[model samples]
Target chain A: ATERPEALLLVMPTDHAIPDVDAFRAAVAAGVPRAVAGQIVTFGVRPDRPETGYGWIEVRGAPVDGVAQRVERFVEKPELARAEAMLAEGRYLWNAGIFLVSAKTLVAAVTAHAPDLIEPVGEAVAEARGDLDFLRLSEGPWSGVRDISIDFAVMEKAANIEVIPLGTAWSDLGDWNAVWRENGGGIVTQGAVTAIDCEGSLLRSEVGGQHVVGIGLQDLVVVAMPDAVLVADRARSQDVKTAVAQLKAKAVRQAEVFPRDHRPWGWFETLALADRFQVKRIVVKPGAALSLQSHVHRAEHWIVVSGTAQVTVGEDVKLLTENQSVYVPLGAVHRLANPGKVPVVLIEVQTGAYLGEDDIIRYEDIYARGDEQGPKR
Target chain B: ATERPEALLLVMPTDHAIPDVDAFRAAVAAGVPRAVAGQIVTFGVRPDRPETGYGWIEVRGAPVDGVAQRVERFVEKPELARAEAMLAEGRYLWNAGIFLVSAKTLVAAVTAHAPDLIEPVGEAVAEARGDLDFLRLSEGPWSGVRDISIDFAVMEKAANIEVIPLGTAWSDLGDWNAVWRENGGGIVTQGAVTAIDCEGSLLRSEVGGQHVVGIGLQDLVVVAMPDAVLVADRARSQDVKTAVAQLKAKAVRQAEVFPRDHRPWGWFETLALADRFQVKRIVVKPGAALSLQSHVHRAEHWIVVSGTAQVTVGEDVKLLTENQSVYVPLGAVHRLANPGKVPVVLIEVQTGAYLGEDDIIRYEDIYARGDEQGPKR
Candidate 1:
């Protein structure tokens, strides 16, 4: 009780699905006392199936709700046979990698185990800058920080590690199969999907107009986005990483970038692009303004499809309403702003010799991005 | 042999793939004499695999080159076991549905059997009209004719049907699996696709820039188009028909229509569409002209991305080249024509209260479609 502290920190992966918030809160509250007492606490979920895709954690004794248990050992994701055996043993739980610990204890564990990582990571945080909202770490120090999970660097080597049995359904959702499993198991259909005679499949289309069809298929995952589609055997969902690497090696833009580019104010999607022209659907939040910019090699036509837009071309400033348009000739300085209560939606047609996003030259920006030229637009 | 006539009619399915032209010509040449001698000749290919998706012909005698054999019973697409057994039997051949027969004999045979079809079909031919390069059959009579295949309507009932062995590579391309087979099997890929640790799979993206990723997939078919994505078991390729029918029942447009709308001139593909806006990339064939028309509900902005376009807006007629654009206001009679030797490619952005294809009122059309507006352009 002498090591007990007043504050404790809980670490969880943001992308994981833990739908029962109250149950999760109760489990975290249960672990907090042990964590404050200088015992690094991990949470474990009872397994319902012999899932070979997740790490299994063995407990020393019977697990009780709201009670921390002594850790036996950590096991990596096992083969089907091993997973079945572990499931039959009745003491193994899914290692969800959730952790509860005091800040001092985590720091001490990291320093004791991965001593080499402490300096660069600490420097990165020390030199971080507040960019409007986000605290961006220093690039130079961050680049030197080794890319590793806390479990491999600290939990696996710590001596005072303990686990609390979480009384809620949880899933890491590490891959598409996990997503399929999280959607209640039998033929998960999401967004513009039709399944005929399909079982244990995930047929998903991310966009509204893109329909996904599955026929006479078993245990498959088909995910369709605007620019890319992924089809994989549900059992082999983890192997999608290698396919992504192959796409990256071939310089496919979809490997690293999404079709919709999000910005501080709103977002824009390239509807169509070709050699000398590009069409974009842009939405600007109310009171948001794009940087005063112009392209040397392109002329743009902006049509206000919805809401109101305050448009500026050269020295002329005009308010364009729905179904109104303006043409910005090549080299003309222009700016588009949503000065109304609603978001401004516009269709922009760019005609140019080179229509790359890098062709922009910003003269002024209200969002504090003045001269920096990137693909943010 | 007196059944032979001086003229022969060879019928083949246009959708079939017969890559060996010389071999096909030789086989046709061999069957020509037999067909001219008043025999109804049907071509059969040697079975290469246990294909359950195609009809099988049981031949009594060993096949010889340029020789005809007496007709045997026609077996429909069989189960896997029957297909495998037939594949093992050396006397079985794939009934390709190609037929060679004399016109007089076919008409006489058709008159003898299936007597009800002759009147409606003959009336449809009698009332046919020439529209450009296509012979337009009278819909009244054509609709009265039963939707039946030649095999079921005539060939199966005809006692004079004889089989001719054709030594040529062929494929009906009945479904995605047949496309995979045509593409040379074992991990067939088309367009932008990346595969990792995959075997016996067909991963295809119908349009460029749409990348398809397949990982650890086996015996599967994945096809991604602009409007729809289909993932199915390779052996269940034929069942895609049921999926399509289900889509049709659900009133999915992709089930019946393609994304690209083809006109007599060229084609246009819709890049994006919203409630009141539509963007299309249109390519007009050289020397082709859209109808002199006006839309009451929508206005259009046409940006010439490539080649040259002769534009007509009211009394103003201008030739716009690459990187140039023109605006056609609502209720203004406008026309777009490709007067240059090369095709004209343009991006059309429409903004309106109602942007339906039926909103057009045409004055004149060089393609001879006048006074009848049923969604041509």
Candidate 2:
């Protein structure tokens, strides 16, 4: 493996809220020396409540900000009574999972603890190809890597790991209750929503053209997305995972799949779908192009709404501005490209007898896709 | 006035839930003779709870099914204490406002009490013109008529007004609370919805392709429609009218206007809209046709998904079936007629520089409209 052994890596969860960036930076800077000395520094937070949801790090000394302390042991998420007893004992800190470690230390820890993951993960990383601004990881080897958290695989089992307390307001936003706490336990709202007589609630309408209204709601969470919705008690936000599991069991598309189809050329969403026709609002990123493809059953009519598009229909390629249209007959090889510096937005109407997402014939794909059909576009 | 003097009229509210149709019909049959004898019979229901939202009728005797008794007075919606007292008194019945009266008596009572409204209402009805299956009342005269409920304008002051107890369970469904009660106070839902750990709540999704999910909701009302959503405390469903008033004061179209545009041809709802393009799902009833129309700023592409449509573009006319499409050029006269024995469903995509609703030039309308702009389609 061509590892950056000397480079320091900071681990942060994506869905987290850290309000005081300066304090986090200070703690990270303070832990850099211990990381440079080949020690794994895991950040912890002083427990403000007997939170049963998080793991606890029992430190040898009191955990303090900007100073690493010796770890006694890492405790799994405890029962409520045990969490309360630990909170009262005053030696336990939340395992925030934020880590700063040198690449060599991480590699050595993983090799010593979980040697089986080394070969497949490295192969997956090495085989990944660049697609536009993102890296399309090699799926073959990646699928073989066990779905395990880094903490269990390397952190908890490794020696020379210290804990540093974060001196900042932080929340993982792991659930709706966490989000509610992050918003100061008040009625939090976003998007086109109207709340009346609601207390300690969060109402969000994340999709366009959908309005969410909450009335006489208390300690409830209502989130409206395009294809799915989540309405739950703030206290039961953790149970949403169970609901998601149930949805996945039923093979619902909205269980885990996002509403919009993301491709290397930006994204597209179906505005409307019927038995014989479908309408989509497609956005192509600046300088990005769709696959040179054609459909066997569907004919498409594309009308540009904003920016400009380089449209290919059969042997002809032309530029289409706002309000300009192009027709691609069935089986006519076509493509759409954004040549301008802004995103190209267009509406596509596909008329067909058999309209499924698998009816596409891709002659070439810039994203390195093979004959795998997409949206039958 | 040309009065059908002997006609016996039974008043049934559009919003009421009279689940037992035979019970309602039997009550009507019993009241028919009283109504024919010129005694105004107002139906009353036995109170199931101390509901303060309903008006009450103080009858001279114990109310019984299928028998008319003298009405002492009509008490307006009362406060909690008064409604509770009335519920215990056993002589009070809900003034259901379902009246049975002869046309001559109704006309005479209105002429004696609300005489100012008689001329305008009579003229409006007299001048109403037939448009399709509906009669379009003369707007000028109708607007001049005073807005008053029949109970206030005629029944409350009329002598010999009798209260007949209805032998059935019924609900006006005047508010969301009433709907919740009608649904038996459990988790009531309609359309695509999921309720988790919810009790005493109503969750509904009235629009197509919209999903509603609720969790841990109690004593709440959530209604999702195409343009507006109502979420409120089940206890304070009455305050929803205040929210509506607020929206009206702010000139929000969703406050009072419907999202669908209803015309003689059938109806159409906007599937999507943007600055330069709009998509609509239009359904035309069998044998119905749109006007010969053209838009100055937009061109339309119509793709039929169901039935058959006789489409006229400029001077060319063709019959299109499922999966067939036609392009209507800007400034070219076109019409869509459903000639088949079923509704013709089509998706219309409009491309334009300005996509306003009033951009139409109507040449001829079978529904008898003059030069007035419509979806500017």
Candidate 3:
């Protein structure tokens, strides 16, 4: 078989388990050159427990040559003692859900091992199209392909697979506890926390959450998101998916999603809200402009607290400096900008009947937000 | 034989206890007048501890036919158990080291009790002088009174003695922890604190005179003063005196003093320091001016980051606004003022052989500080 010039690197992030980025980058680079030598190099992440949530791979034989070996068998999640024994012996590597192989090599190995995965994937890539920064696979073959992981279709049965043991710092940041561990002091932990006789515990505070004071605690993680809070042991953080699903089932917005997200323009956050009123702080970057939009149900008031703001309201255009305020009635077209070389800080208060973000109708946008159906106000 | 219409209120504060003014005011209004009943009223404060570091009160009964009780005994500190018993007994109140008694009552009681304290204190107050709103007691009698508390000569000897319990918030500001608690958040706890699983533990975070990060903490009472930190139990905050004595015997500032104090006009604080450089944030209120002073060992750079400032360097006078900076060479007469209505914030960076608060040689005075015995820088 002829080897293709390009290689395919398939990566599967198993929840956020890596604790350091430098180690992960080093591990990824360690096997890159070997995979380029026509050998299938795979990183087998050893399972920390007999976790049924993740698929597993079993090593069946020794190295094929200098770079690769054949897989004897692949298993779903195994029982506890079996997993322990597999770890005791030196031959098994947990399915890392990651693969690195030349395109020709992967196709050839899968063909000899599990040919079902190749046809649809090949057909989809052959008809692939480009859209902006992403490659769009053809719908017919892409959707027709069975929803299966590479571990189940190829690595478990392939005859030329090799495992590379990686001791690296990595994390998927999949849950709140993992996020809290990595971001303890970077964000706000307000009001007061008393930690005594504890280590490796991550605690976060929200603006109006309960006054949390940890005393004689160890390795505990506490997070105060918007309306919901989480307190868990770090080792049990993987169960956060179950927690998030429960929250979704109960219709808790705070547990399912974050209230604020950064955007290219700047940032907007709702400080407080009621049925008839909503308050928001909008920070626009220097020389950035917002969309020319109008709210069907709301009247708005903009107060400038710092820097300078350029405002376009209906037919009038004005330059508002610090302490100055402006008003826009319902259905009035308006837009805001930072004309100078400094950030424009402004507070926006809206009064409306149905104060939902979807009430906004954008006439024009500078950040191409019109294409994506974003929440509006 | 005759019942006089006077008594003295003696309050003795413990180690570094800063009294809370509002709470004391509330307590006095609610408890004092009725207890006084237009007769002599005195407060007897029990000293929490004693090792000769603070003045002590010797108590005895006053002699009278119908109204006076004879003082049979007097003694200094008797040890820890004695102090604890004094606190537990219903008859004793903490010697808060403060008093509120009519002039007539104190004079008569002192004459009948110690008989020696009356003349000196009377003569001193009679010849009392005033300077810049402070009552300067005459050195002759004021200094001659042996610096004894009123408890020894007045409260203990009186036949009819009554104590209006001060249940209000009172802090003597005995140390940095007291200051931090009185000035900031309202939570306190103790033990070997590991600020995991929590937020806001006002800990004594100074380690060998270095401040450490209380991760996952907020609104904490951290008392990292000059050289030590006493991470005490918040609820058992009354025990701070024990910690202070422990630090004071070791000659550490963290237990004894704060890094900064507020003057009537403004405030100054040491922000950071190195072996060769030091930084301070100085504030001057509206119409307030710093003394015209010069340093022999260090030059200073002043940056005006907020409000407006009138800066004097040698013979030159200039107005500095936000973002403007000035330089003062060593031995140059320098003064700063807030010419505007708002407070002026100035940052001072010093570089020289020595940078201490006592390095100043004042040529002019604004707050009468030029004549006072200055600190050792």
Candidate 4:
């Protein structure tokens, strides 16, 4: 409802690599006049290949000013031979999903073609709540809206649609191969990666102190994380989702979570896990506090390595600075807070017969997650 | 000298993979009698392929009792065509280097062919010093001896020679391919390894918590260690030594040393190393003690996690059990000893401007290595 221009630009999520920004901008400018005149203008790219992944736009005639043309029809992804025939016909363009329309025109089109979506979306937007800096939509109205794209809802059936063709180097970086291609081919390596006799491969190590060695590899992708690793053929990079699915089916925690747990206070990572003891490097953000909690089965030894920590153990409270340490006996209710302007980093060593995170009983939590256990912090 | 049988056996480093111990033992037993009769008998294996990697032993005649035969000569590794011809002729066997001879006969052979070696070797053995239970050879005479193998010094020119063909499954295990063959085929993996569409490959990870993933890899070798990794084609596995040589030329510590340093007392591994700080997990065997030492630039905090430690700090001596810790300030002489039957395991956190092992000066050491630094323990 704020004061602005009458028209709006809707950029749909069509994964693309647009190399010629000037040409793209010029093409969009050509459609701005038409859009302002109440026409919905969709930008398209000249089909260099018979791509089976993108939809096509058929123009009614050649562009009036060699920039924009009237739209004849919108077509779904076509078969390879039919796509080639359309390409030979020289009237089809690959849909890039870039749209420009007047706000009133878009509302009119949606009201005419898809009346069922407006009420729920409007209600969801009206009932949205402010969460910190994010606006959270009302779940009831949002979930009630039908799951459909704008193409099926209004764009395909709208009259007064115009099409503009853009010629530029574009690619959809949908997989590792696409990324490799975007990187200008050859071996793409990062971190502690050593590649010998490797071509058209991507080898990356995201974990510190981890090394990846690739030898005589062609068209392959290797990604090494701290807690998990992935190796996939370059052509089969899209199938990496299958690995995620398999890991999820197996109920592996690494499938959906990382070794370092992020929290409102800060972050902590388990350095080592053993049968009777566990070691973690905990970092608390400035002016952040942890829950007042106690563990029945564990005793903790905290060594402050950086900044300052205000620790409360039992009825005693003390501030520990760098190079100092404190011990918390078993069952002692303790809390750690960073009160300084810098982060407080400490090494926490927990020893017990049963050191499961479920052994904790939270008394108070500022983040309102007292019932959450096992790495909520 | 002690009174015993005169005959002796010498097992050269053949790098063999003998599958049938009974058959090998019987083959050696057959040669024992001939060796006792003063003939220098060398066991050979019948050629199964035209292997160009091993030397060939020519037999003078067929095995008298399907076991032992007179040896004609030993030939060096031949060209592929020559090896094929020899394999087809059926009179040659691979030189297994398994020798059985009477001690007096071996002495006579050495006297005849390598006269200069016997005197120096004998003097070196005679002047060997008894170090604990190990006999340390006198460096003076040992260094003066010629660097020649027994084959070139004696067996190649000996007057009395014999060969016993051993028809058993044996592999030299000279490379990864040989190891893969010995492992009975496709995708041999150890530790935490996941293979997807991999064939005829060897993937091994020696470090705990390390995982190796292979995808669509054919005839490749991947070995992951704590501090280094190696990946090579299976056919080029022998060239892994070349990689080691290159690493050595670059003066990489991982080329020759492992992350865990072993000592006479026990072992210790660096858990983490950072600027001006280091963490080590040290294990001390029962009845073992570290040298009384002091570091000019470092302070140490030792936390005993297992067993008991007898710690001496300056003038005070204290016994610390599990869950107890002690701090040694910089320049304070200290010693740690394991007095319990089990090993004393402790986490040592070192903090200093200079945390190098060379920063320490030892006052007293029961192992008699006071001047040694850098993990001599």
Question: Which one is best on TM-score?
Answer: 2
Alpha carbon lDDT of each predicted model? 0.85, 0.84, 0.58, 0.78
DockQ leader? 1
> How accurately is candidate 3 docked according to DockQ?
0.02
DockQ of each: 0.57, 0.49, 0.02, 0.31
Residue range B44-146, candidate 1, lDDT tens digits: 9998888777888887887775678877878898999999998887888889889898888888888888888889988998887766557878778998998
lDDT tens digits, residue span A1-377, model 3: 23444755656576657665576566667667766766677766655555543445566653221234455666667787777777666567566556677777777777887778778988898887654345767767988888876666766666666666556544335665546655652222333333443366665545231233343344555554433344555666776665555556656444534556445667776554544556566788888888888988877767665679999999999999764667777899999989988888666666567767778888887665565465742
Off by over 4 Å in 4: A1-174, A353-359, A373-375, B1-19, B27-43, B53-56, B62-79, B95-167, B205-207, B273-279, B294-301, B313-316, B327-332, B349-359, B373-377
lDDT (tens digit, per residue) of candidate 4 on B111-167 = 899999989988998988654335767778999999998999998999789888766
* Reference contacts reproduced by model 2: 0.51
Model 3, docking class: incorrect
CAPRI-style docking class of model 1 based on DockQ: medium
State the displacement of the C-alpha of residue A111, model 3, in Å, after optimal TM-score superposition. 14
lDDT tens readout by residue for model 2, A1-377: 25568899998888888888999999999999999998999998888888989989998766667889878888888999999999998889898878999988888999999999999989988989988888977888999999999988888888889988898877878898887778777899988777777899888887666666666778888887666667788888998887777667766556756668888898988787667788899999999999898889988888777889999998899999876778788899999999899999998888888767788888877777764334533
Which candidate wins on lDDT?
A: 1
Chain A structural similarity (TM-score) per candidate? 0.89, 0.95, 0.69, 0.69
Worst 10 residues of 3 chain B by lDDT: B62-71
The 10 consecutive residues of candidate 2 chain A with the worst lDDT sum are A368-377
